[model samples]
Target: MSVKIRLQRHGKKQKPFYWIVAADARSKRDGKYLEKLGTYNPNTNPATIDLNLDQAVQWLHNGAQPTDTAKAILSYKGALLKHHLDGGVRKGALTQEQADAKLAKWLEEKAGKVDTKKEGLSKAQEVAKAKALKAEKEANDKRAAAAVEAAKVEEEVAVEETPEVAAEETPEVVAEVAVEETPEVALEETVAEVAPEETPAAEETSEETEA
Candidate 1:
């Protein structure tokens, strides 16, 4: 029976967690497994992985084929490297002490790289947050300036309209004064013409009475 080292899917939709296991290749993906190796959680920053290193190495030595993703996990957790070093030792390519020293050195370098990547990610997040806040503040300031400009325009319009209204009222007042003066002037002219005719008629009547 062909045994495969692979991941079994679990957790809810959009949020996934998995179990790394060795199972028969013909078995259902989430069905019975031969051995539970570890767990993998992709939700975290660095993608959390927990593994039983000795069990994983034993399984690999037993010819359990790992899927591509599972292989990457094994490599990341140093299982694949450890197995390679052991093979090198068995083949007389290197001493066990030398292999262990090499692995230790590689792990130290890998840890340093991981730490640098995490620091870069954190700095990038802070910059993005600051940029977002600055953009929001700038937008608010622009809106406030636009509001002030609109209010100033409204005030200027009101100021200009008040003078026009005052000008219109002045013309109406002048027209009213002219209308009142015209009627009084016409009455004075009529009284003066009638008084002259009355004086002429009285003088003619007195002469006829005396004759």
Candidate 2:
């Protein structure tokens, strides 16, 4: 029976996630598989891949032909490199101990690279968040300043209206005071005129009696 390495679709539509499997060549795409080697999820920021390195390399050594996508996945996880080292050991070009040392060193270097990439991504996300916060603060400040300006203009308009209202009331108050004073002056003049007429009549009567 021919063996093959391929992806088995598992997640929902438009959000695809897969399982790496070693199966019989005649099996359907998502049908029963001989062995599950790993998982792949592309929903994450840098995509997530998890593989059983020993099992995958063993399958490769057992003559399992991997599909193009599965091959790339295996390469990324260093399964292909490990297989190459094992082949070199079998061919007597290198000892098993030397191959193990080389693989350990390579895995260490790859880990350091992954750590650096994660750090860079974290820093970028922080910067983007800070920028968004700053923009929101600036927008809030602008709105506050505009509200203050509008209030000040309304206050000024009210102040101006109050003086105009006072000016209009002043003329009415002055006219009322003038009307009250005119009535008192007219009464005084009438009393003076009556007293002069009475004095003249008394003088005339006395003059006639003396004659």
Candidate 3:
């Protein structure tokens, strides 16, 4: 029976999680597994992986064939390298202590790289968030300025319309003043004409009496 190292799908749609497993080659993809090695979560920025390194190496040593994606996962987690080192140790090409030391050093370097990547991603996220906030603030400021300008225009229009309304009423005021003054002027003229006519008639009567 051929055994294969593969991944079993789990988690929700679009956000995939997986279990690294060793299963019979003829078994259904997610149906039966010989042993679960670890888990893989791709929802994170760095793609979180948790693998049992010793178990993975042991399976590789036992001739368990890894699928393409599983191979990459195993390689990334240093399982393949550990298997190779173990092979060298068994072949007398390297001592067990030396192989262990080399594996420890490589693991340290890989961890450092992962840390740097995580830090870079975090910084990028912060920058993007700040930019979004700045854009929103600018949009709000533009809207506020527009509102203020609209208010100013309305006030100016009201000020301009006020003169037109006053101008419209101005004619009525002038007409009233004209009507009040005209009555006084006409009365004075009538009194002057009557006095002149009566004076002339009195003089004629007096002359006739004397005659």
Score each candidate by Cα lDDT: 0.95, 0.95, 0.97
Q: Higher TM-score: candidate 1 or 2?
A: 1
**Tens digit per residue, CA lDDT, model 1, 5-111:** 99999999999999999999999999999999999999988888999988999999999999999999999988999999999999999999999999899888878
Task: Return the TM-score for each candidate structure.
Answer: 0.78, 0.75, 0.80
Name model 1 segments beyond 4 Å from true: 173-211
Candidate with the greatest lDDT versus the true structure = 3
Q: List the residue pairs that clash in candidate 2.
A: none
RMSD of each: 4.1, 6.5, 5.9
Positional deviation of residue 74's Cα in model 2 after best superposition, in angstroms: 0.8
Shift of residue 204 alpha carbon in model 1, Å: 13
Error at 169, model 2, angstroms: 9.8
